[model samples]
Target: MIIKTVKSLSQALLLVALTLVLHSCSNPDEGSAIETVVYPSDVIPFMDQWKILLGDGTHTDEVEDYEAPNFFYVANDGEADWVVYKTPNAGVTSRTSSNTRTELGQIEHWTPETGGKLTGTLKVKHVSTSGDARAAASYSVVVGQIHSNEGNENEPLKIFYKKFPGHSKGSVFWNYEINTEGENAKRWDYSTAVWGHDMSVVGSSPKTYPEEPEDGIELGEEFSYEINVYNGIMYLTFMSAEHDTVKFTKNLLQSEFTSKAAIPKQILTLYVSLGRDGIERKNAYAGEIQYFKQGAYNQTNGKDPEDNMVWSTGSAIYDGDIAKQYANGSYTEVWFKEATVGPGTAPN
Candidate 1:
């Protein structure tokens, strides 16, 4: 009897040992299998400095550790992760404009005399392919800008990228919207070419395309821009590996078009339909408070090209359906690797 009892005790001990071993093996360290993904704020730390509006009309001021899945997110391009800003050709837009956009508006405001500086390194991934070629704004996207916070909410500066479908290259240009001296209805924009024809150049017909610029930048190509408004002087610098670097200087405190005679032919043709023939103020954007903006401000829309060819883009919209618009290639996507914003520096 004693021998039988001792044997039973030994078997019970063996069973307990096996159970402990199995439990430890089944539950390994919790940290071993988890991998963290980097976000847009990780690449560009300035996201917290401004507020963002998504293509779906999502507005948020907290962007430091925030990201929207389809509109604003981080994407890996085989080489590195980039912050992407994408928007449909037609979607919910801001109250002041009819165009759609996924862009950032700076929180801080400044005047022409006080000045500010903004820099960005980015690439245009895609743009709307279908639009009236004769329209001044068709098939174009605004990447960066300076907008007035008061008065007519007019823009002081807008940088544009335009490319026709099936074309190998696109034009890069910047526009200066006049701060009307009196009536705000007289406001107009003047454009300057960086690597192609200015905004004034357009096709004779809706289907026709002008000769491609020889020194234009192509889609997916990398480029950088610096907009420095220092001591009432606006200085611009554009750089790309495929073309020569370009630099321009304009006075923000003074008007280049004080009379109708100073208006360019492009503005005459582009604004003729819109009735924006107003002359600029003697002091262009001098005392007015302005803010900066960046991202994909889609210039295309679903409006009929026949009504207003220049501003109206006839792009396809699946009745405000985001997934359908993306599938149909009716959206704009831009990626930015680096950017900075701060007080303007003193001129050398």
Candidate 2:
């Protein structure tokens, strides 16, 4: 009978193509999953490791008053004015207005009072003339001493463990995630910013998240990061394999970076140093940690909601183009010769 009706229609088309390949491998709607970009470790162990006990340390006016909690101070507000005094340490912590500061930038964790690593001084000029017309000014002071930890922004590492007796409870909260693939796998949440002090090396983070998976389709690439240190407190997470692979050559510390607008263009600077032995040496965890990705804040749903309360960095200067200088402080540079955006984009 016609070869049994063509062998019963070729066994019903191989049982409907194996039931649609097991229903599309069990239905996967979302974006599919794949995204990664996180940085803060280009090596930078030290080269001269920032040692400017005074002037020859560079920049002057009696060496622009740097007491040495490590070191870094860059400033300039033109037009002319005054009223600067950044003194902390001796105990009085308070700076959780959430986030906002940049005019020059840098006043991070100002705490120092004879505590083995003590130093604090900032008195830049310009108070009136609307802080010098506002168009633009300059500032750059690179200092170092690394080690970071400071919680609260949703419990960075909630302290008070009986006033911090080596407080530890399995520490966790560096959560990093990114995603985006075919269907709709969207899931890119990462924004907590605020935790500085925990040094003894180990701030470089990266175990996985730099890849080339192969067969299963991951020939795309891969990368993942995680750094956790209890007691001394250190928690970092990067996790990026796709969503904009993430890459930044130099950015002299301004909270490592969150971005909105504050990086105009200057040679770029950094003198960041952290590693004062245990517990970051004498309490109050060293000083000088600056990085300002880009300034001019204002944004809610998209991100940076506004509050750039005009920070400060010693008499800044770097006419170099997309600025590039590291180690001295760690971030804040701009000097663009070309390539404004799109080599992979994402430095704004």
Candidate 3:
């Protein structure tokens, strides 16, 4: 009888010890210190601090609105197909370069010209035909401009922006068809994309985009193009463009689309043209983008329009306390204009 009583007491002690351990592990302050996992929602507040959302917290100011947003559903074979959303339709408007019919769907075009800024609402919805499908999660996205032209007049198609941060420069490259993994990707997540002229004519080689972050998708179910910039030189695979593997790289940047972001001091440049394909190009540093407001007098070449419309704009970089404006409209070509990479370095 005494041994039985002792065993019960010992079990009670072990139970108490287990409870204490669990309590310690669960404590957010002391003990094991519960680690708070940061999901997309958790980091949104920080994104707001950077002021990347369009329309602040409201839904009225849409960067570009579609009566129905584009939808791609996972087919029975586990492949995601580009399906149209009946409720919120999707199609390329007349403003866009591409002409996608209703059956093919459309995309609303919004660029710096639309507002010179991208802060707005994009409502996305999904409905499942099967009961076991993933629950439809709606989203509202804000796309902001990151970089404009390459600061060279010869190449006008180059445009960059923070589509959703935590991606790579190529994420914003020209004509790359971004196949997001899930629905409501723009607002629910972040990515970055950048593109430039591929000076090397050697050409036609298999290419890879910059490595994507764990929280993002790089080339998920999409035919991406090859127009990546490393160091100072840019590469473009014509084969990719010819086959429409991705959108034409030059057109991608020229469209002047703003993507949502989560960084301060985002630099956006819009390139006009990269000069001719085989002509002698000028140096890139010659390009100088000055302070020219939209609908204001542009003083780049002392050329003033009757309406005082600003052609393009560039950001000034600090060189040893000298804030020199890296003119996006300064050059005609042959040189490379280095963008001031902010604290956020390209993901290694």
Better of 1 and 2 by TM-score: 1
Q: Runs in model 1 with CA error above 4 Å? A: 1-32
| Per-residue lDDT over 3-65 for candidate 1, one digit per residue giving the tens place of the 0 to 100 score | 999999999999999988787688766337777767789999998799999999999999888
TM match of model 3 to true structure: 0.23
lDDT for model 1 comes to 0.88
**Total clashes, candidate 2?**
85
lDDT of each: 0.88, 0.20, 0.21
Cα-lDDT of candidate 2 = 0.20
Instruction: Decide which is better by TM-score, 1 or 3.
Output: 1
lDDT rank, highest first?
Answer: 1, 3, 2
**True-structure RMSD for candidate 1:** 4.4
Predicted candidate 2 versus true structure: per-residue lDDT over 1-348, tens digit per residue: 999999999999999999887776787653477654211111111111122221112222221223222122222235322112111111111243211112112223221111111111112111111111111111111111122223111111111000011112111112111111122122121222112111111111111111111211111122232222222233333333333222212111112222223211120111111110111111212232211111111010111112111122121112211122122212222111111100111113
Worst lDDT run of 10 residues, candidate 3, spans 290-299
